[model samples]
Target: MKHPSQNSSPSLDNVYRIYWLLVALFVGRMGDLYVLLSRRASTLRTYAGDTSLPGGKRDPQDHNIELTARREAFEEIGLPLDPQKVPLLCILEPFLAGNSLIVTPVVVLILDNTLRPILNTPEVTSLFSHPLISFLHSEPPFATEPEMLEMKYHTYDDVSSSTRPGKVRLHRFMTGRETGGTKPIFGLTAAILIRVATIGYARAPDFEVNAPGQPSQEQRIARALKHDPIFREAAALEGIDPGRIPEPSALRRQVRTRDKRRARSKL
Candidate 1:
């Protein structure tokens, strides 16, 4: 018998030298896609308070991104998924961080979700899950209003005693959380989920059914840019025009004017 786990698949190398990373978007049998995110512990340096997905730099012994994703999931949150049932559905485009790291998101449908995560307190304080659809909705929950996420970072050279501005990006969008989940997902994660929803479901995951009132193509895009701060750079990395990036204010206008809709996105 050929075990599915041993089957070959594409993945980012685990040499540990490549800046590549992997995140798990685990979907359960009930069709509820869960984003396994971790809250950085107080001791961490970067993104100490911000919530991000569960995955990290690969161990040199890890074979591929799939192994890296699973290994990271367990190490961070104790999500022990069976390799036989959990298959990588697709690998989203690599995202570039402000620090120049390329991160890839690996989607896996978990046949089971009973395992509990053992928290690595120094690295991750806790972990949580939110339905994937929360990020797709257009109204009060996800895209209620236009919000600006202007991130300004600076780097200091210890030797020269000089400071230089790092990445300057503005993220404008609505909050994509519901219930008690106040922690919104990072911008790049939202981009990956949007692609997954459109490709796999043929519709945005914002709701159970698509209707006339749903966000138009332009509006949906505007929302995505708002969530992801570095999407523009990511697109440029793929050889797309940076001008295709939409403005945050324009997206706000579209969302506010629900009575009118654009037939197609301008950008």
Candidate 2:
């Protein structure tokens, strides 16, 4: 069988750096596929009580991004670091977070859905999961949680860039606190899942995924490296040449072809 990592973009191999962080989308099949997630500890210093994936910044001792993701998962939720049990699916391209941290997503499939989670109280308060495909569709999965009087299930907000001219689309999906859910999954977390679902399912979202005029993912990253001193300094420290950033057109086409082939093969 072909490995999941084989489908990831080639450009990911060269972008590791200090400011780079990772989030593990621990996908599992429970009749339907679902993703494991945790709510940040309310007492933490930053982003307290926010919904997030199992991950953190890359440590100097961590040799690779995968290890960083596993280590963070183990620390925050007591998820074991055995690759045989939690094998990688793919590493999605990097995303520039609002905090200026470059976040990379590491998608892993949880082979054992029955494995119990041990939560680290200092970093994570509670753990819950949502249907993986629900990200692609705006409607809530269950009928138990009815919509709030005036609240929308999906919301799109345009965040204007301070360092550049274009705006980035911010997507928020209401989780509806069905049973074991926390707040709405929005911002970086929501955006990451949308991309992951698209890649995993080999289809476009039912709704428009990006803002009408937003730049492509690669273009945004390239612009950040060119115009933001913070990103430039990090790239310099990592010995990455800003001039070598790949254009979005080539990479986008490559991904589209790969997705088409996978669809044909029923992979």
Runs off by more than 4 Å, candidate 2: 1-30, 144-149, 178-181, 239-267
* Model 1 lDDT tens row, 24-99: 5566568667666677676788667566666776665666667777787777777675765566677766654343
Instruction: Summarize candidate 2's per-residue lDDT along 1-267 as a digit string, tens digits.
Output: 112244343222333332333344454545667787788988999889888887776654667778888888888888879988788788888887775567888888788666788999988998888787888886667554444646677788888877766788899987767345467888989999998888878888788887777877776766677656776665565557766765555566776888899999995
> lDDT score, residue 105, model 2?
85
List the lowest-lDDT window of 10 residues for candidate 1: 152-161
Candidate 2's error at 140, in angstroms? 1.2
lDDT for model 1, please: 0.52
The 10 consecutive residues of candidate 2 with the worst lDDT sum are: 9-18
**RMSD to the hidden true structure, all candidates:** 13.0, 7.0
